[model samples]
Target: MKVGIADTTFARYDMASDAIDELKKRVSVDIARYTVPGIKDLPVASKKLIEEEDVDIVMAFGMPGPEDIDKRCADQASNGIINAQLMTNTHIVEVFVHEDEAEEKNLPEVAEGRARSHARNVIKLIKSPKKLIKDAGKGKREGYPDLGSIRR
Candidate 1:
């Protein structure tokens, strides 16, 4: 599978790219990386990359709000593209929220695990069936959901 990864944060992008590279080595996968100026540029950058490369999947990594991410995904969809956003907490306040919850629950380990689990879930969601179809079409496979008649 060919995957395209983009992010606004250089450090996050570097980390995600390294993780993706390790994932590709474990499994059979190809990844392409793109760095964007900011969240506002994501959709445009993604669109350009999609047009230029043959990718089976396009995953965007950033700490943007859910609404912003949704808007970006909608924009990509309008252009017949599939996009997934991976949210990260880069703000100290966000980390404080987690820490507070950990203190309240008296399960710091559990809280940490939850954060890791959520990140994994995001990646899993990006690999869903609908996304697979969209990415496949963007990659080597052309058009999806054929309308031809079934002949038995």
Candidate 2:
């Protein structure tokens, strides 16, 4: 899989790059990294990267509030972009701690745990094959046998 990781904030970008590298080591996937100039640049950057790289998946990492971040993700999706946002309550906590403290206290592990949780959430958001089968059965009762209306 070809994955693209994008972020407007420097810290998030760095963390995302590190996460992508870690993930690549675990899986046979190609990763491309991008840093947006600002929050406003996310949509454009995401669109361009997706088009240029023909990316199979995109992971957008940012520290924005939920509403704004959601809007950005929606915009990317509307542009035919498959993307995931890395959001967490602990974003602030991770940003505040020093690297030494983060390592000494196993913050990287904590961050990895958070990343894995986020990845799982993203997978759920994308709807798995099992979910499609379940929905298909419900759709049959609703007079739609295919249940292929759900768009990625």
Candidate 3:
């Protein structure tokens, strides 16, 4: 199996590094990495990876700043990613960490943990999607602790 990693240079942390490490530990797959200048470029980068690299899935990582403008950009970028998914009929796991999600001292840990957890999800998505379905309503999160299902 092959995996595509699209990361942005503007990110405060190198999330792709953690993701690659986790992927290496969990599965044996070819990794195709594409680096872009900012989060908004991720959609094209991810699509290119899917088309040119022939990866089965993509992991798009970005860190938006703690600003309203940044949030808007993130939202637009996310929509573009969704459009890319529909255009290609492929799954692009969007992993975005906002700078304000945690205190400055804890930001790295939060970002890394999020990347690693999402990496695991990526593996499950390809190898065993049933595993994910089994956890429906479980409120699984990437950086933070999972929130158990409220359903009875």
Candidate 4:
């Protein structure tokens, strides 16, 4: 199977690299990479990867600044991604990290962890979707601490 990675130049970190490393460690698949100027461009890049590159899945990464406009752009980008997924009937896992989500010193770590985690999920999504069902309500999180399920 082929996986597409659509990343933005605006991102503070190279999330695709971490995701690629993680994916390489876990599975063998072809990767189609496309880079654009910013988050708003990810949807089209992802769509092209699927429609033209013939990738089975896509990982879309973006990092918006901590401004209101940035948040709005992210939301719009997310909606476009959803529309692209519907149009292509493919899964485009959106991985967005806000510029202010972590301290400057920790941003890279946060981005890397998130990318790696999502890479695993991508594997599960294509290879064994049942595993996701089994993980339901487990409070699993990518790039951050997993909030374990609450129990009495």
Give me the candidate number with maximum lDDT: 3
lDDT of candidate 4 over 1-152, digit per residue (tens)? 79999999999899999999999988998999999999999999999999999999999999999999999999999999999999999999999989898898898888999999999999999999998998899999888899989988
Candidate 4, overall lDDT?
A: 0.95
lDDT of 4 at 63: 94
Error of 2 at 80 (Å): 12
* Model 4 residue 43 distance off true place after TM-score fit, in angstroms: 0.6
TM-score of each: 0.42, 0.47, 0.98, 0.97
Who is ahead in TM-score, 2 or 4?
A: 4
Model 3: worst 10 consecutive residues (lDDT sum) = 143-152
lDDT of 2 by residue, 131-150 (tens): 43554533221111234445
Using alpha carbons, what is the TM-score of model 4? 0.97
Q: Show model 4 residue runs off by greater than 4 Å.
A: none
From the highest lDDT down, the ranking of the candidates is 3, 4, 2, 1
What would the per-residue lDDT of candidate 1 be over residues 1-152, giving only the tens digit for each residue? Answer: 56565555422223344446445644566767777755445554555545566554455543332355545643543333223222211110011011222344443343334333333333444455354344443322111123444445
lDDT of 3 by residue, 19-86 (tens): 99999998898999999999999999999999999999999999999999999999999999999999
By the TM-score metric, which is better: model 3 or model 4? 3
Scored by lDDT, model 1 comes in at 0.41
Residue 146, candidate 2: Cα error in Å is 33
Clashing pairs in 1: none
